[model samples]
Every structure is written in C-alpha cells, then in structure tokens.
Target: MDIQAVDRVGMILALFGPHRESVTSTEAADLIGLNRTTTYRYLNSLVNANVLTLREDRTYVPGPTLVQVGTYAVGRRDVLKVAAEPMQALARETEITAVLSLWGAASPVVAHVEEPPRLEVVVSVRVGMQLSPVAAQTGIFHGFMAGAPSVVRAAREMDDADRERLQSSAHATVRQGYAAQVSSRGIAVLAVPVWDTHGLAASLALLTTRDVLDVETDGPELAALSRTAETISRMLGSTRPAMTG
Candidate 1:
C-alpha cells in the first residue's frame, strides 16, 4: 500500500465528523491542509468510488457504500454477538424494550433492538435509528467512549449552560453506571454502558413506560440491567470493575 495514498484517504474520512455532514472542496482542503485542486481531485475520486456522494450544492457527504460498510462492520462486532441473548432476556424479564446502541458519526445509533411480548404500549425503536446527542438519555456514551470528548465537541454547537448540563450528565453516568431520561411521550429510558478491553463498546438500554420504573419498585430491574451489562463486558474481555449505583 502506498503510504501517502493511505494517509490522504484517512484524512478525507476524518474530515467527516459528527458536526460536518457535508463539506465543500475548499472546506475539505482547508481542514485537511491540502491544496484546493488536490482536494477536488480526491473528493471526485472518492465520489467515483462510491465512498462519498456529491450533492447538487457541490458539497460531499458519506455515500451508500460507506453506510453499507458501516452496517457490515457493526454486524460483525463481538459485542453485538455477545449481547444478543442477554438483550432478549432483558426485554423478557422487564417487559420492556431492550436496545443496543453504538456511537456513530454524530450520536448513538441503534445497532440492535428486542421488544418484549405482552406489552400493550411499548416504545417503538428500530435498528439504525440515531438518538439525539444532546438528549440526557445518551449520556451513557458520553461518559464511557474514548472518543466521547471529540464526539461531544462535534455533535452540536452549544452554549455554556448546555455544555455544563452535558458535563453534569456525563459525570452522573460515570458514578451510577447508567443514565435515565423520560421522553416527552412519557416513555422512560435507562441505559447502561457495555465495555470492551478498548473502552466503551456500546450501550445496553431498557425502554418502558414511565409508570413501570418507579424509583421505589425498580431496584431489581436496575440491578438486572447492570449485571447483564457486566456480563456482556466480560465476554468482550473488559477487565473494568463492575459499575455501582
């Protein structure tokens, strides 16, 4: 492999972060420290190769081929493989939906979902859905992923107050091993971190009605979730100590 070619490709990909969904050739050149002519050539070559898409506005975004590659990579991850059975059992035990999410370009994306039977009004979640980075529920990722600081910085432009809230939420998630939020629709979501030897691999979450998660009554449910996450982490060779509330 030609080292220069590899470096150029890597730089091109790195230019597309959570904040930048699309970029013009000039912007890409400036960001990557390449000349405008070289940037245009590289961008066009990527577009031809289906690694990126050129928009009508002359900007570029990740294309179908990148998405296809990402989906395949997510599917083959060991964490998802180990999480399958435990996630299903979690949904069954709590009668709530179980979600497995991974950090993506701008936020957490659902990598897998399992819904419980006999739930009259369960929340609907699908694989590949992107959760809001600013939402309190996603603090689980912010607290654990090694790339979390960069992700947070790129996901959205925020004021000081918003930054403070995000920091506070992340700190709380670190202390409790999980994060919880009530949706506007009255659905409550609790999420726990799943670790790998490399750091945060993903998040395992339970989604249920607000009424089902009474603080006084859901102790066992919370414990079960934590244990399940620890089991998954162990399967992935994580040696981190178990999280405690």
Candidate 2:
C-alpha cells in the first residue's frame, strides 16, 4: 500500500500547525530528513494535489483542498451536539434566537440555530450562511479569533476609515470576549465565543429586537449567554476558567 510514501506525506503535512503555518522546502527537507531535491519534489506533488500552495516566497501553506477538508472536519465536531440542549435553553431563557457559528476558510459561517417558541418575529439566520466579516458582529468576533493576519488580509479591500474601525472592533471583541451590533430595523445581535481545547471552536450568538435584548457587557443577556457558552465550552474540553458574573 506504499506505506513509506504515506508516512512521508504524513510527516510533511504534520509540519503545519498553529505555531507553524508555513514551511519552506529546506525546512521540509530537514523535517522529513530528506534531501532538498526530494523535499521540493514532494512539496510540488502536494501542490498539484491542492493540499498545499507554493507561495511566491517559496513557502508552502495550506491550500484550498486542506481548507475544505478542515471545514468539513470542523462541521462534524461534537461541539454541535454538545451545544444543542444548552442553545435551546438559552433561546427559552432569552426569548430570542440562538445561533451557533464556526470559522470558515475566510469568514464565519452559521452552523446551527434555535429560535424561541411563539416568537412571531425572529432573525432569519440559516445554517451555512457566510456572514460579512466587516459588517456582522459575529464575523468581526471570528476575525479576531482567527488572528490579525487573516483580518488584515480580509481588510485589503476596505478603505482606511473602515479598516480602522474594523480593527478597533476586533480588539474590543477580544478584550470583552463578545461582539454586539444593532441593525437599522432595531434587531440586535450579541455574539460570544465558545472555545474548545484548541481555542475558539465556534461562536454562539443571540438575536432579538434591541428593546428585547440588551447588548451591554455586563447585562443580563450577556450573562445568560456567557453561562450557556461556558457550559458548551466545558463540554468541548475548553480549559478557560469560568467568567465571574
């Protein structure tokens, strides 16, 4: 079954992780204990397979295929199962809509949602909807969670003032552990991160009319949402300490 080849490929892929996002051919050669020529050849094969992209600077980064596979893997995590009951309870407690989102390749994508019963009006957030990173509070929160490089790259199309505001919002999200935005229609969305052992695994958001929901940092809604998110995060093996209410 070409076991040796498989092992070598696995080694190459293993070179990528949180601390090491890219690798040069020389680095790959040293990591795989192979010659530079052989390492370059292997990297080229991976590039052809769409698992890695050879950047202009000769570094190899995760390519489209890896991102697709990663997104699929994230979609199947137990976070969804762990969050289901808590989200339903949250919806009941807040009398609003509860949404679960995951980090997509380039943005935040809605994964699941729970709406309060008998609520004639609710935000129409559907699963698999890709949110606007520059516009949505949830997306800005995820952009912060994704790290600064991703934010800067995504903001390349933005004007200076918008970029400044976006950066400010992202930092605020990190410091406060949540993001909030109110729409012109008086709809308010408050989003908080649901962390896993590996960091932010998903975002949990509550949506309702501005009058029905308070977006204050220490408000009742944020407290309830934080509690529910804590429950889910603990279930997902997050090591973060419980927030003091």
Candidate 3:
C-alpha cells in the first residue's frame, strides 16, 4: 500500500466524524493539516472514486459507494447466519417484529428483520437501517457494545437529563441482562444481548404495538425473546449464564 496515500485517505475519512457530517475542501484542508490545493485534489479524487459525494455547496458527504460497502460488510457477518431461524421463530411466536442488529459507525444497524405473518401494519425497519443509540428502544446496543461510551459522548445536543437517562438505561441493561422501552409512538421494544466467546455479539429485539404488548399479562412473550437470544448466543459459542432480566 502507498503509505502517504493511505494516510491522506484516512485523514479525509476521519474528518467525517459523528458531529461533522460533511466538510468543505478548505475545512478539510485545515483539519487535516494539508494545503488547500492538495486537499481539493484529494477530495476530487475521492468523489471520482465514489467514496465521497460533492454536494451543491461543495461540501463532501459519504457517498452511495460507502453505504454499499458497509451494507455488504454487514451482510457478511456469520452471526446473521446463526440468528436467522431464531429471529424468525421469535417473530412468529410473539406476533411481533424481530430485529437482529450490530453496532455500526454511528449506531446499531439492522442486519436482519422478521415480521409476523398476519401483521398488516408493518414496522418500517429494514436491513441496513441505522437505529438511534440513545433511544429507549436501542439501549441494548449502547449498553453492551465496546465503544458505546465514546459514542454517547459524541452524540450532539443531548441535555443533562437525557444523558442521565441514557446512562441509567445502559446500567439497567447490564444489570438485568436486557432492556425494554415503550416509545411515545406507542411502540414497545424488548431487547436482549447476544454474546459470543469474545463478549457481546449483537442485540436481538422484539417490536410490538403498545396495545398488544400491554394486553399480554403473561410473561411468555418476554420469555420467548430471551430464549431465542440465548439460543443464538450459544450457537455463537457463548457460555455466559442465562439473562435474569
């Protein structure tokens, strides 16, 4: 590999941090400590290569090529193969949508989703859709993913209360071995961590309409979700104890 070219590419890519979605040539030049002409040439090369897009305002953002590469990488994970049948059974048994998600650049991205057969009003989730890490519905990912603390810190415009709430949710998730939340949209989500030998592998979540979730007096739905997650964890070679939460 050409070291200088690799370094310049890495610097250019680093400029698109969570807080900085797009960058102009001058801005990237200053941040990357390169001359303006050189930076502009590099940006143009990236745009031509389809790694970055040149917007009308001359700012650069991640292009379709990068998204396609990310989607392809997500699809190649072995965990998706292990999770397929369990996720399907979870959706069928609970009559709720089941999602398998792995941590992505900014949040957890859905790798696979299974919708109930009779579900008329389907949830809009799809494979490769990025989910909010701070949202109550996605606490499991932030709670267990290795790089979650830095991601929480990088999240912009969060109030003190919101930060505290997210921190509390993470703690609760670890303590209980799972996380649950009822969104203001009247959507209920329950998530359990899937572990491999290395540690937390991913999150398995069940999504249901609030009405149906509220009516379930018995704990069977939650039990089923936990069982499925545990099965996946075992298949991934995890020997961790069963989730008590």
Worst 10 residues of 1 by lDDT: 146-155
For candidate 3, lDDT tens digit of each residue in 1-245? 49998878877886664457899999999988999999999999989999999999889999888778866876677789889898888888988889888776456767788998887776647776667656644577666763655455435335677767877898888887777777778887778888899887888888777777752332778789889988998998988865854
lDDT tens digits, residue span 184-218, model 2: 88878888778789877778888887888767546
Residue 215 in candidate 2 has what lDDT?
70
Least lDDT summed over 10 consecutive residues: which range in candidate 2?
135-144
Deviating ranges (above 4 Å) for candidate 3: 1-42, 48-50, 53-68, 146-159, 215-218
**TM-score per model over all chains:** 0.75, 0.65, 0.75
Candidates' C-alpha lDDT: 0.79, 0.77, 0.77
103: Cα error in model 3, Å: 0.6
lDDT of 1 at 32: 77
Instruction: Please write out the lDDT profile of model 1 over residues 1-245, one tens digit for every residue.
Output: 48997788877876665456799999999887999998899889999999999999999999889879877987789988889898888888888788888876556778888888787777767777777755644688777753656575543446777667777888888887778777777877778888899888888888777898743244877787888889899999998866867
Error of 2 at 168 (Å): 0.9
